[model samples]
Every structure is written in C-alpha cells, then in structure tokens.
Target: MDLKDEFYSAVDAVHNNISFEATTANEISTFETSIRFLGGLLSAHDLSGDARLLAKARDVGDMLYKAFDTPERMPIPKWDFHAALDEGSVQGSPGQLLLAEMGSYSLDFTRLSLLTRDPKYHELAARITDLLYETQMTTKVPGLWPSHVGLTADSLDRGSDYTFGAEADSAYEYTAKMVALLGGQVGQYEEMYARSVDAAAKYLFYRPLNPGDEDILVSGTARSHAGSGAPWTETSAQHLSCFAGGMLALGGRLTGNKSHVDMGGKLARGCVWLYKGGPRGLLPEATMLVACPDAGDCAWERDIGVWHDALRRKYGTSKPVEDVIADNRLPQGWVNIYGGCYILRPEAIESVFVLYRVTGDRKLMDEAWEMWAAIDKATRTAMANSAVEDVNPPGGKRLRMSDSMESFWLSETLKYFYLLYSEPELMSLDEWVFNTEAHPLRRMLS
Candidate 1:
C-alpha cells in the first residue's frame, strides 16, 4: 500500500491549494472536473475502502451537479459553487450536447449512487444517455453518432463530419463501463454500446490488412455524406480515439469475443503507430486524413453542392478535404496543424496497457517503456511537469514547453503506468472496468 498511500497523500494535499471560502464561484469544467476530481476520489474510496474519499466525492459531485440546471437539453457550464450563479454559454442552441460533457458522467455518478444508496445520482447520469438514445431514434448517421448534437436540430444526415477528440472524446467510454458498473441494471447503455459498435463496424472500422494477417481494425468516424453521387468518407483517427481499442479489447476479453479482441489489438497498434511514426515519438492530437485519402472525391459535377462550395470559399480549394489534410502536415513555429504538443495525454499508453493485459504481449511493454522514457525526458521541468508545445524540434534540439500540466497526468497517466508496470494479478482486466478517467471499478463479469 506504499504507492497507494503516496498517491493519496499527494492528492490530499491538492485540496489545501483550493479555497473553500473564496468569494468567486470556482469555474466548473464538467469534462475535466468529473473525470479527474470526482472520478479520482470515488475510485480511491472504492479501492482503499476510505470513507474520507467518499465524503470528498460527495461534496465535489454535488458541487459540480449545479451545471445540470437549465432548460437546455445538456448541462449548463461554469457554475460558481458557493454563489449558485451560472455563466455557461448563452449561444447554445437548445438540445445540442457537448459530447464530452454530455456523455462522460456515469462512472462517478453511478459509484456515488452505490455508496450513498440513492438512485438520484445514477438517474442524473443515466438521463443524459437516455437523451442520446432518443436522439439516435432520429439520427442522421446510420450506425455512428455525431460527436456533437443539438436536441431538436434538423435531423443529422450521413454526410456530416464527426470527431473523437477534444470537444468529444469520452461519451463512448461511459457507455460500456456504465452497463458493467451497474451490472446490466441500466440496460440502455448496453443497447447503445452494441448499436454504436455495430454501426461503426459497418461504417468506420477500417481493417487495413491482407486477408489473414492479425487484424488491425482502425476505429474512426463514419460520414456517408456525399452529393447524390459521391462515396462515403471514413474520417481520420485521433490520439484521443485510442481509448476505443482498450474498450473493445476489455469488452472482448471479458465477453470472449475473438473478433473484438482482434480489432482491439489492431486499434491499439494503430494508435501506437502514431507515436512511433511521429516526429518525436509523441503522438500528435490529430492524425490528418489518414483514413480518408480520397474522401468526397467525385467527378461528373459531383453533387457535393453547397457544402462543397462553402469548403472551396473557406480554404480556396477544389478538394477541401484533401486540402485540409495537406495543411495538417505542415509545421508552424510553436504549433503543428496536426496539433504539435504532447499535452500529457494518456489515451494511447492507456490502450497499450489494456492491450497488454488482454493479449500478454511483451512487445507492447517494451514499446511503452520507450515511449515513457521519451515523454519523461521531454516533459520534465523544475516546478512541475509541463506540456511540450512543439515536440518536432530539430535533431538534438529540445522540445518547447507550455505553461500547463493537466490533472489527467495524475488521475489517468500515472495511474495507468503504475498499474501497467505492476504485476499482472493486480487490478487485472478480467476483474474490473476502468472509466475514461482511469478509475477502476471492481466487478465480476457476466
């Protein structure tokens, strides 16, 4: 328990840095706060049987719950906990969900319900997902979901683009884990996970391999929007989307599905490829046009009508998608179009840890070891670890530093590394499902 004690002590000290008596409402960032703070405290309580952790989780969870107020379909943003004042956007179209905010609350909230024996927290988290299901009842994409949505907007069509990054990353994660955490008590999550994955396999799962080689299914966005005559587009995968592989692998390994296991292995390999092939062995935020080489390419006055015209006007190109991809390949001074910084993100190696636990391959461990060395070398600073602003420095040149170190550095990154590097019997994948924030919830799989 030495590591656990150290972890608890370090995190406990963080509370002293905040002011409970501050006059202003602390900015409530649901996406970050829920995963790092609420998820951390709750998971610690689960793992250590610590009541203090539960109390902190309750306080923070209730404080952040203030954002859920509003007539809008999604939670409002940025509430002052003490003042009861909200400063979330006034321009939101009703019902449009921020995929990250809307989709990623189940772990902490469900755990809160388990601890408190109150269903309100579970219902609170479950309701947003119910809304997502309702939206799918009228979806534009057949099997895939838009990364963002407005509750009552014009029905989404097959041709619109979607993402698995920043504005939307963790929704898909919450789905599978929620059902697992609740032991199928909340069946909607199960339905949504199955439906989404089925749709994705048909539309977004790109198996870039020969007939019989080990499967390397790259999971990305699926957009079938074409002029009346053009082809559907498979979008590029992001570093963030790396989480999909682990989810699939864990789901497959837990359920005994060889296909999902194969795809999960492949997807994990694909994300690692981004880091290995990147300039400094640090994954870029986006991998541009990798999955969509000729997306929207059509001839005979391809019906891409208005959106195509708008694309041309914005970027001054006949093939906007291709142009955008090309631009992403360029490197600016402090930033790269494909997102140059290594912002202490943990999704790739997190998947690597999952893949290793699922498959027991030593190669993944060696790769992860090297990757960790590169990151530690690049990100170390005197005061605290900083994000690398531009990792693509000249040979033997050091990376530029950014001013921030995100909380995931502790909650997910360090946690995964510790677990991954530990003995296999500890927190084994067969026994637990971790939420997007890397909080392990212990449960016996069906």
Candidate 2:
C-alpha cells in the first residue's frame, strides 16, 4: 500500500484492537489511551473528510469521553499524566504525556470541545484553564512551580513542582499552544498566558550561568523546597527533544513577542551542538551537564541512565544505546518505541509547517522533506499503529507495536506531517485534537 493507505490501515488497526472501556485499559499503552492522538487524526480527516477515517476517529473519541466521565470533574488519568494528581486535584494543569503516553489529557480535549461545539467540552476546557491559572498565579515565582490547584484561597497551594523535561508539567508548550489558539475566546486569559509565557521564558529558557551561550538552555529547572532552597541545581539541567523549541514557538505565538521567536530560532540552531559531538549526527536524548565554557566533566550517567532504561524497556537493555540512530537504522532515526526519540519529530514538523506558512520558503519544505525522510525511514510502522525502535547499537531488542499512543503524539506528528505535504488554510487543525486527545478532556475555571 501507499503512504496514505498505510496510514489509514494503521489507524484502523488501533481503533479495532484498542479498548477504551476502563482507565486501566486506556492507560496500558501510551498511544492507545490518547484522546489527542485520535483528535489529531480526526482533525486531519475533518479537513480531508475521509468518512471512514473520521468514523474511526470519532469512535475512539466517544469511548474516551465515556471513560473520562467519572467522579473527578475531569478524566482521572490512569497513567502518569499528572505530576501530583495522587495528592489532590489540578484544575489548571494542561493535558500532557508523561512518558510518551500517560498523564493529563486536557489539552487535546479542549480542542475537541471547539470542534464538536459540545458545550461540555468548552465548559471543561475553561474550568481547567481557570484552575491552572489560579493555581499558578498565587506563587511568588510561578516560573518555579510546575502546575497549580483550584481557584479558592484554600485550594491554592504551591505544593506541586515539575522538574524540567518532565513532559507532563512543562506547561509552556502545551499551554502556550492552548492560549495561542483559544486566548481570543477567553479575553481574561490573555494576561495569564502572557505572564505564564514570560515566567517560562525567564526561568526555563534563559540560562543565567551560560548567559553568553545563546545556544545553551537546560531542558529542565526546579528547586528542592525541602532543603535550603537555592538555584535549581545546574547539574539537574539536561536537554530533551524539542522541549525548549516547542515552548518557544508556543510562547512566541501567544504573546506576539519577538524575543520568544528569537529564542525559538536560537534553540533550534543550538540543537546542533548536541548533534556535532555525538557518535553520529544525533543529539543526546538527555545530558547531565550543559555545555559550559569551563568545567564539563560532570557525571552524565544519570542523563544516559534514563535513556538506557528507556532503551532497555523499548529496545532491550542488552546493548549500548547510541544517542541518534541513522535513517538506515530505523524509519524514524530510532531503534525503539520510546517516545523521546520521536517526540520532537512532530514539533520539528510543526515548526517547519509554521515557517512555511509564514515565509513560503521552499527551504522550509526542504527541511520538512529531510525530517520526513528520517521519520519515514526511522519509524516504518503505520502511522495509526506505529512504534519506533533503536537500531544503532546492534544486539539491542526490538520494541513491538503496542497500544501506547497519545493524542498529542498523533495530532502533533500527523497534522504537522500532513501540513507539509498538503495545503493549510483549507485544512482543519482542531484545538480538541491537542486538548482532549493529548490531555484529559477538561477545562479550568475562567
């Protein structure tokens, strides 16, 4: 079959096999439970209007919406979607993928609200956004904390903190995108979005020690409130795929701030450093030490350890995991299904699509083509039922195609990918794809 056929077949396979009956079932695979993933596919079909695909996508959304209806005002994430959901409620936390597939599912669900024109979807989206705003605003430094609780003074607690690179809590990219698209509807939220983006750019994107290294930004930043609270340990910083890049794009669009645009550009170019020194032209998935002018011999073991664990689980721990596998290795430049490797694929694709839309540069198409080539080769699985692998360091295991899917992963990857190959204005890229599928289908207080 051709690419489109392969894509549709893949989606069909997941829709037929994956059950969204219970939270446990949905939580099993990262992709299987993702509302955003399905939402993106649906959005694509909505634009494309391929009835079969839309039917398949709509079924998944229906199941997910049903599964999410519970005592919790929003969907109770069966997996690691929320950072502190175990402790209490998080009204403002955007939907996030905590390890590729599990965590909050709010971001994509909100988009679904907009698409279906279901008042409940909008109501939930608003509620969730409001809660997140309220939770975050009270903090003296909202930049330091990951997410917030409800609106009331008592509910307002700055107890939860997100380590940078922890995909779930890094609301910059998720919220930035949310606000950029939806801010017009909620006039009051415009300021909150502006402040949130400012906080993230100031705290996370801008590095103090490596101030001169315009290319260098730590993947995450956080403080240990338990002990003497000092600057979040520099050693704690590491680089993950497109964390800064996505947020930069999100922040730029939300605020119309050129600085954010500059930051995004610099961050994208700075990614080259991660590529230049590695075994291949591949960037390290994680690094314990940021490239400094001075000392550089910090134990990067923790950074690679997480990679190794992920590699082993996805590809098997029997071999060394090279940072980036070549195109010949796998269809998507990865040897395993760990989301980190392919996580940035969509972001890069989205960035390319956005640039092309803005600049009409064939070079943007060239970039998209190059990225697609790597993705197509590195990740050969059907788009709907696809999984990635690590093949560089031979003797590693192969990850089976499973149910670990997410709406964010699908929406971002596919929509961006499709946009590169097709037109934009005529296309329907719904907000719900990102909110409901990518996040729990709920909204914060407005």
Candidate 3:
C-alpha cells in the first residue's frame, strides 16, 4: 500500500495539468472549490512537505480570492472565474446567499495565510465571519441564521426557514472548527458556536418515538412563529445533519461543556439506530419521525391507536391510515421515508469516527463495522460501489443500483471508516481538526 511511485506520479500529473485559469464550467462553487481543492492541497502539503503541492494550492487560492471582490467584500457564493479575470471585478448576486457557502471559508483561507505568511487571506475570510457574528442575533430567530440571506444589498435577514441541514449545516460546523484551527485565540468563534448550538438544542433537537424507546436525539427543522411565540419544530431528519453529533462533541471538548458532549453521544447513537433500523442496514437520505413532547424525557407510545391517530392527523381521510402505514412499511417511529435512496453520504460515519475519538467508545467502532458490512453487501459493484436507489425497500426485495458516486464517498466516507480502525495515535484529534469535507488540517497547538 506504500506506493510512493504512484503517489508522486499522481502529484506530478496534478501539478502539471491542473489549472484554474480556464475552467470549462461557466461557474464554480466557492465552497466546494475551497474545501475540496484548496483544503486538499493544503493538507497534502502538510503531510508530504512538498513544495509543488503548496504551489498548486496557492494557484487555486489566488483564483478563489477573486470571489471576494464585491463592493462589500463579501464573497459571492458562485464565481465566474473567467468573467472575473476579464473584467477585473466581481459582482454579488441579488438572490439568496446560502449560509454554508458564505460561512465555511475561514479554515481554508486561514491555513493558506499561515503557510504562505500572508495576512490578506485570513483578513478576507475573517470579514465574512465578522458579518455572520454581527448578524446572528438580528435574524428572526436569535442565535441562529436562516438557510439563506441577501448579500448583494447587504441584508443578512432575508430568509425565515431554519435548519441545521444542507444549506446551513456547515456554518455552525465551521464556527466550532475555527475555534480549534486558530487555537481558540479569537474567543468570538467559541461564543458564536456556543450561542448557536444552545439555540439548536432547545428548538431543533428532539427524541424520536421509536419502539425500543432508544435514548437518542435527532436534529430537526424549525419555523419561527409570526409573533413572539416559540419556534415550531418539524420532526423530519436529514442524513446531512448527522454531522451535528461530531460538531457538538468537538465543540464541547474544546469549550469545557460536558453537557454538549453527552448530548452529542445521544445524537450520534440516533444515526446508528437509523442504520440498524433500515432493511439494508443503511440509513435513508431523509426520514420523518413522530417526536416526543420532551426530548430530555421521552417514552415510546406503546398504543397502536396513537400511531393511527397521528397518521390520520397527518394524512386525513384522503387515504386509509392502514394504507399509509403499509406504503411506508417503516419501523414504528418512522412516519415516512422522504428520501429513500442511499447516496453514499459520509455524515453519519464522520460523527461516529469523531465520537469514538472523543469518548474512546469501542461500541461505536463495532457499530461502524456493522454499517460498513451492510453498505458493502448492498452497494458493491464490479468496478466500485454504487449508490442504492432504496435503502428501506419493502418485502426484502433487491435494491436498485444507481450509477452515481460522489467525491465525498472517498474523501470523507471511506477515510472515516479507515481511521475508525486505525490506531488512535494516527491523526489523533488532539493534533488535527477536520474540515467539513473531512480533510484533516493540522492544529496549530496540541
């Protein structure tokens, strides 16, 4: 496995051929480019101490720097690289700006600044974080920003829907990670993370009414009420939100909050339960669950009449409650499968790896092994593993295969799986902190 020749050959190819000067795509995602390419190159250079990798990373970093040329200096989520190069200026979009896209750039740019001994990169990234922190309390829901905001007119309070899901997940994640990456010297990162996570736990975290009455928590969405009432919680869960467990656990360890660590374990276990609950032993991309009134104290509703009544309230007389139940054919607590496909996402395992590191829990590793076995058996293809169309198919039928494999399948999913079994000393959390894409950037202080 120590194929040095192959590694150098691949590096040489990238160094020689890869260029951001002429991208074929009309537009590129700043978040995706920063995390996948810039973060990857920086981590690779840190591991190999190779000048070429740093050079290539610098090239990518320069291209990404063009994204912050807006009038307000806030980065445009999507950058037209060629157009910007030609015009020597960039314009911010008038549409809604995603929270994750705008907020997830601090780590990569700050790392680049440290390595290159340039303050400009860190300064540019810090401006965005400053804006986010300033606007955090002004949103409809204090301490939590919506999924999107208006950046062109400098309005950060544009959207109302809130969730720690796809569009908004990594914003909170970076807040905690930035605390580690900068050696917690900033203080504001920790404050921002603490406030946001506290709000999330109060409004978004809930216990599912599973038949086993498992003591675990799942993050859900919340809608701010029109008046001064509490935000209404939605019981739907997303596979992407699985990262909250690791985020919370890491933040707790960094900030000396034992409660966050305990809650994190509960959240991590919920995903493990979902993996084991599915027919394929893999979690669906998204699912709806019946929530207990109090997440802190929950007991399973044993009466089938309650489930029937809940289904009736959800579906009405449009369809028989029995048919609705049979159509989903899910476990007792799961009301329906919003997204049935398993697209080889890494969020669940990412949390498992992190929790194991934070708690030294061997049981988490065993659970991870079971998940890997199930996923391999169901998704293995001749060339490589493919995604399955249905993770909870009825009647034990075969899972339909899809010809899609995302980059994170390797960068994050398998990396976390491998690290779970590796020695604890290898990439220990004390010495390294992972970005959203699971790239392990070396911590400045251990």
Candidate 4:
C-alpha cells in the first residue's frame, strides 16, 4: 500500500527516541534487539536507499559497541544501557549466555561497517564469530556447542544440558548465512558449518520409533561427554529445531555439497512428518521423536506407565545408562516429549520456504499450504489470532486461545508462507540470505 511515508515517519521517531551512541536507561539485547531493531533499520536502508535508515543503523551499531566490552572478546549477551554513567549492572561476563545471543551478531554489524566505511564494526562482528569458533573447538562434542554457557561454566566437561533449539538455534544459522553473505571469502564459517553437519549426522541424527509407520530418522541433541559416548536421547525435536533443514540446505547450495543438501531435505521432510503426526494437523511446540527406552528389564517387566524407582537409583544419569536406556523417564516413553500446545513457531514453515526456493520442490510448497490452512483453522479468534492451548481438540474444538501473538508470527512464519507460495523471483535466494530472524540481508561481495 501507499504507507511509505508513514513507515518512514515511524522509523524516524524510533531513530530519534533511541540514543544508539551511549546507553541511557534501556537494556541492549542481540537476538531481540539486533535481529529486529537493527535488522529492521539496516534492511530499510538497503531496500529504499534511505540515508536516514543507514544513519540509524550506524548509531545503533555504535551503541551496541558497549556490548562487546568483554575481556574474552565475547559480547555480553545483554548490556546495561546506562553503562555510560557506570550505573547498575554493566556489560561484562554474563552469568548465563545464550548461544543465539552470542553467536548471531554479524550480519547487521557487517552491513553497517560496509555501508558506513567503518572498521570497528567489522572488528566487533569478527570477534563474536571468532569466539564461536574457539568455543566450539573446546566443546566435548566435535561440532555442536552447548546451549548455555556460563561466564565460565561447562556442561559437557561439567553438567549443563545442550540442545540445538530456541536460544541456541540462531547461532548455527548465522554461521552458514555469514558464509553466504560474505560469499565463501571467509573459510572459517564454511569450515565450522561443515564440521557441524558431519557431527550432527554422526551424533545428533537418529532413526526413531515414531508414529510415522516407517523407520524415520530425525535429528535431536547429542548427550555424550569427553572420553565417553551415549546413545541419542528421545527429546522430541522442538519446532525451533526445524530450522536446521533450511540452514543445511543453504549451506549445501552455497558450497555445492549434495550430502548437506540431502541431509537438509530429510530434516525438512521430517518436520513435515511432525505436522502429519499431530492430532489437528498443526505442528506442536514439540513432537515425539524416539520412544523413550525402558529403564531396565525390571523397569519394563514391572509396569507400563510407572517408572521403576530402583532403576533411577541405579542409573543416576551417567554414561553407563546409555546402554541401559536413553531418556529414562517415569514410563510410556514420553519423558522426552514435551506435549506443549501448538505455539505457532516459525521454524517449520521457514525451512519450507528455503527448501522450496533452493530445490523448487513443489511438494514443499503444497506442505506450506496445508500448514497455513491448519494454522488458520486452529488459531483464528474473535478478537485476533490466538495460539491453541492444545491441538488434540477437533477443528481446534474447545481450545483456549492465547490473546498474544509472537512477533515472528508476522515477521517470519507468515512471511515465509507468503514467500513460499509467491513467485520465486520476488525475493530470490541468489541475491539475498535472511538473518536468523528472517530479515532479508542482500548477499553482497566486497
């Protein structure tokens, strides 16, 4: 529509309100702030050649510089905006750092630097990627990094749970995308991505006993320690994990690696398989992967729905339990499955857009349509769209509707749906690669 002036004025107000030079009372964040605000400003400039947008992007980039003021060169996941006056809780070693926040810093910064002719922005961007490289190198898993890291805590060498979902998902995505954005000029990203693909294949990927009626393989988390390996757990892959397929496919297409593309296709189809298994045909926050293995022969022979207390006392969640039973839970093998309501996550359909774009697979397009219809049937409400509390109800029958809508629902999921079904040339993948948040960043070679 003819809303360019309104959009420009609105963005101008935001630009004036925010003091990107130094922190005031606002807190700074990466995944939320950078991916949306910064991504928005930079994207606007690129799309419309608006100098005002570029200026705002530069200011935001400068304001974000304080976030990187860490000893280890790792950007603090969150920054205190008032650190300019040295107020409460400044940026430094984070108590807990999310991988997505730490890892997904580059595209916006890189764009800012290229446009502004500033080297500092590039330096800041490089440090985050550099830290990601070193952190993955030290991790117990060959390619995968832990989901959460302390200012200095280790889960594998110590005990923190790891999963390639939610906060950790975007980090891996940025790696492949940075490679595409910079055009293979950077070898480190491609190298790290390759290692991750291989490691995921060997460790995280599994053939699970699922409702699909066929032996279907899906990727989950790897729970092995140094000098010890364990069988993959039955953690139902979250819809967040669905992005792996697109990320994989992007990596493969950029590098001419068929195996990566093939693996990505499987993961993408596996996500569709998840939708197929749901009661209402809408994807849940999570889907059942492998059925949880029995705790033990006694654990199984005793009861079907009850867990064996003695088995828990015996296993104690160590490497020894791998051979006994992975994801040993109360019973029924649902211990790994978080039967949460369908929360309209974007990862599944997001991947469909990518796979369809790359392979031109019309089947993926059809799946996207099916998913859209299911979402419409399940989520439409009297006031506005709402997420279902459960998908088990027929036609979303008696489903409690959430009043709130996630930003990604508009920015990403539905956007992907439109693009997936739109002309392939509208936003051609050859000219652009989206940020983890689905903001289109033009692929420019320097």
Best by TM-score: 3
Write the residue-wise lDDT of candidate 3 on 1-446 in tens digits: 36789988989999898987778998898889999999999998877888999999898889888787777777777777777876545475535578888888899899999899988888988888888888887777888988887663357777777888979998899999998988899998999999898888877888887778789999998887446577778888899999999998999999999899998999999889888887678888898877875555666654455556778887786888778877767666777788999999999999999999999999998999999999899889999999988887777687889988999999999999999999999999888999888888888886
lDDT: which is higher, 3 or 4? Answer: 3
Off by over 4 Å in 3: 87-95, 152-154, 225-229, 301-306, 318-322, 393-397
Ranking by TM-score: 3, 4, 1, 2
lDDT of each candidate versus the true structure: 0.65, 0.45, 0.85, 0.70
Off by over 4 Å in 1: 1-26, 80-95, 152-159, 207-215, 224-231, 289-337, 382-384, 393-398, 444-446
Q: Model 2, range 1-446, lDDT digits (tens) per residue? A: 13787777766776577544434322433334444456555555644456655555555566555434433444444534333234664334323323222223435555555556666644654654565566565554553344333223344343444443544343444555555456455554556556755665554543312322334444445443434454343333333434455456445655677676666655544443333332233333443333332323223332334334433555554455553333214322122322333323344445445544433556656655655555445445654534433223444445333334544455456656666667644232323213322322222222
How many angstroms is residue 165 displaced in model 1 relative to the true structure, after the best TM-score fit? Answer: 2.7
lDDT of 1 by residue, 53-87 (tens): 77778877776665665565346545445545445
Residue 67, candidate 2: C-alpha displacement in angstroms: 4.7
lDDT tens digits, residue span 289-402, model 4: 443243112223334223332334445545444333433321222233355577778998888789888898888877777878878887898766787776654333477776
On TM-score, the stronger of 1 and 4 is 4
Q: Can you give the lDDT of residue 201 in candidate 1?
A: 66
The runs of at least 3 residues in candidate 2 whose Cα sits more than 4 Å from the true structure, single-residue gaps closed, are 1-37, 50-62, 65-72, 79-107, 147-164, 206-218, 230-243, 291-345, 352-446
